[model samples]
Each structure stands twice: as structure tokens, then as C-alpha cells.
Target: MTNAPLILVVEDDVQISRVLQTSLEGAGYRVAWAATLGAAIGEARSRQPDLVLLDLGLPDGDGLSLIPQLREFSVAPIVVLSARGREEDKIRALDLGADDFVAKPFSIGEVQARIRAGLRRQRQATYAEPIFRFGNLRVDLEGRSLRRNDEEIHLTPTEFKLLLTLIEHRGKAMTQRFLLNAVWGPQSLDQAQYLRVYMAQLRRKIEADPARPRYLKTETGVGYRFVPED
Candidate 1:
């Protein structure tokens, strides 16, 4: 229903957006770009691209602020591209309505993979509708958001991907190694502490009951699982 599977690349930096445009087009995707939040919103309203590559630093407003608004109007997946290196920064963006994200200075391969994942999710959403719910937690796959007790819950980039991978896999128990590799990368597989920190953080937000989680079940010496309470 979109025009050429169009993708919107929104970055205040002209060079970055241009480079992304070229890269995406070269890979056979049509792209529209905007250098400001206002312009980006306009592009979304008029063009309605299939996917969006958003940068955290926009000229008019915080890129995160625009996400919930955009989600209200479109089903297009938004993949955030940010240079912010802090764990909190990534979490904040994900908690907004972004579907996926990569820290800036990201490689082309990563971006490509991210785009593929987003499109794949878009397609999957069309056919099989899966809503993750456990206690007060709920994930709207199509809308790319989370709600706690009917109220929205915000997550960051790392947190969002972490949660998605676990919930997507559901009962299929994964390991710390698998979680690290899937969300962080192969190189971070050895950084086991990262998993601990993130898992703890996710519990605080998703657990009604962070003290003892019911849905995000952990497999000590292994990984975690998302088994919705029956």
C-alpha cells in the first residue's frame, strides 16, 4: 500500500541523511529525507514511508518526542540511529515507539540488518498478530509500543531489543550468550555483565513485581523467557 516500500531517513545532518539515502537507494529501496523534526513529521504525513530511520538529534524537537505522535498516525516501523552511547539514552528511545535502533557510527551491515528485521517484522505483523501480555504488561507489535496496566511504558533502544528478542522467542529458552549476541553483537557475547544489567533494568519496568518476575522468567546460568500468565 506504500509507494515503492519507501523509507524515510530523518537526520539533522545533511551528510548522514544523504549518505543513508544513497545507501538505501543503492540497495533497491526508495528514500525520502528530512533534516528537521518538523520537516520529518511532514514527510511522514504526506509520504507515509514504509519505514523510518530516525536520528536522535533533530533541529526542532527531540527525536523521541516525535515517535509517539508518529505512531498515532502510521504503522511504519521507526529505526532509530543515534550517536548516544549511554545505556539510558538507548532505553529512552526504545521506550518511545521505535521498533528497533542502532547506535551511531553504525556500520552499513548493521543498518542493512536492522532494515531487514524491521521489514520482516512489518510483514509478520500483517499476518500473525501477536500481543505480549503478562500481568499489567502488554506489547503492541503492530503499533510498536508497550503498555503497563493499560498505561504506556517507555523503553530504551537496548531495552526494547532485549525485550523483543526474549518475548519473540517466548518459551524457547535462550542463553546469556544468545541474548548478548542477538542484541549486542557477537563481540559482546563475552560481556555477560551487560546481560545482567539490562535484565535487571527491564524487570524494574515490566515487572508488576520487579522483586519476583512472572512473565520474564529467568533460567539461571542460562537466559530468560516470556511466558504470558495463563
Candidate 2:
């Protein structure tokens, strides 16, 4: 069996599907594509891809319909790639079971990064012990504790949740909307300022110097990324 992670790209547009396949393969990931929803379901079952990049607009039916069905059989992470940009649409997809969402006309670099993050999170979830260590920072998943050099680091409930979300998907650029939805809730998706405020608090508590953050790096117009130490 091939060791490279397999990604199923469910897109109807031929050219777009080609681009996605080429890009993913170029990044050393094995890819399978299906233009229709039925084909996608079949491919997914047979191949058991490591991740799925789904497009909401499918010729046979709504791609959203496949999310729950896919979930019935596989625990692989699903990242929606579609033209549906409205907040409700995104929330609906997330609620349905998608791990992440990227609207159409997205940067290839960003999508690739998100895919890597999703795969990493999926693997970590299956681990017997999901303890993460980065430099002086350590996160204990089962105990829900944070420590710096063996000393417990105090984090407010909100701050702790935000930090956990980032660390769980470390190495991926999480959009502001995604972060808000995950940390706050669907109603708080519009509250960008809340994220900024909490992120500042997190940085102050965790960083050696908040001015020069090492782990919680911002993605400028996008969102934030948790860069774990090598």
C-alpha cells in the first residue's frame, strides 16, 4: 500500500478538478477525483482516502447530502471547497460534519496548508495519548492542561479553548470565521474582534514576548497558525 496520504477531490468542473489533482499530487499526496456525488461516495468507500476536499455543487445532487453519509463509514477529515460563501452555508456544512471550509477562488497555497493541518489533526485524534510538546510548552489532551517547562500555565476558559483549537490543527492557517465558529459558536462567527482580543490574551500568557510571538502566528488577511517547535 502507498504511504502517501490519499485525498479525494469532489468537484464537477473538469478544469478545476484537474488543477486540484495536479496541485495535490505535486505536493506528494495521492489524489482521486469524482465529478458527481455518487462517484465520490463510491471512491471514498473503496479508496478510504486520508482526507476529502468536497465541492458543494455537484451534478447528481447537493454535495452537502454526502457529508453525513461519508461520516457513517469513515473518520477522515472533510474540508469543504465550494462557492457557498454565506455564513449560514458555512455553518451548515460545519454542523453537518465538515472539518473545515474554504470558499471558491481560494489560494492553492492556503488549501494545501489546510489539507496538511486536517490530516495532522485526524492522525492525532486516533493516538492512544494525544500529548503535544513544543519547546517549553506542553498540552495534555486528556487532562486538559497546559504547562510551560513542567509548570502549569493558567488560561481562562475562552483562552484555553482557543489555544486547544489552534494546537489541534497546528500547521494550518485557520480562517477567522472558522476559528470563531469553533471557539465561540455559530452566533459568534461575526465577532472578529473577540478573536483578536482573546488571541492577544493567549499570546501574552504563552509567548516569551507577545510582541514577537513564536507559536501563534497570524496569517494576515486570513487567520492564525500554530507553529510547533521542531
RMSD of each: 12.8, 4.3
Candidate 1 Cα deviation (angstroms), residue 191? 24
**Location of the lowest summed lDDT over 10 successive residues in candidate 1:** 221-230
Candidate 2 regions off by >4 Å? 128-130, 142-144, 155-204, 207-230
Q: Model 2: how far is 186 from its true place, Å?
A: 13
What is candidate 2's TM-score against the reference? Answer: 0.72
Clashes of 2: 0
For 23-139, candidate 2 gives per-residue lDDT tens digits of: 888999999999998999999999999999999999999999999999999989899999988877776776677877899999999899789878877776677366888888888
Can you write out model 1's per-residue Cα lDDT over 1-230, one digit (the tens) per residue? 23457999889888887788888888889989888888888999999889999998887888988899899999888888999867566555655657666888998888977787677656655666667665767787667688977688888879989888876655434566678988999999789999999999988987777878877787544456565542
Top candidate by lDDT: 2
Q: What is the C-alpha local distance difference test score of candidate 2?
A: 0.86
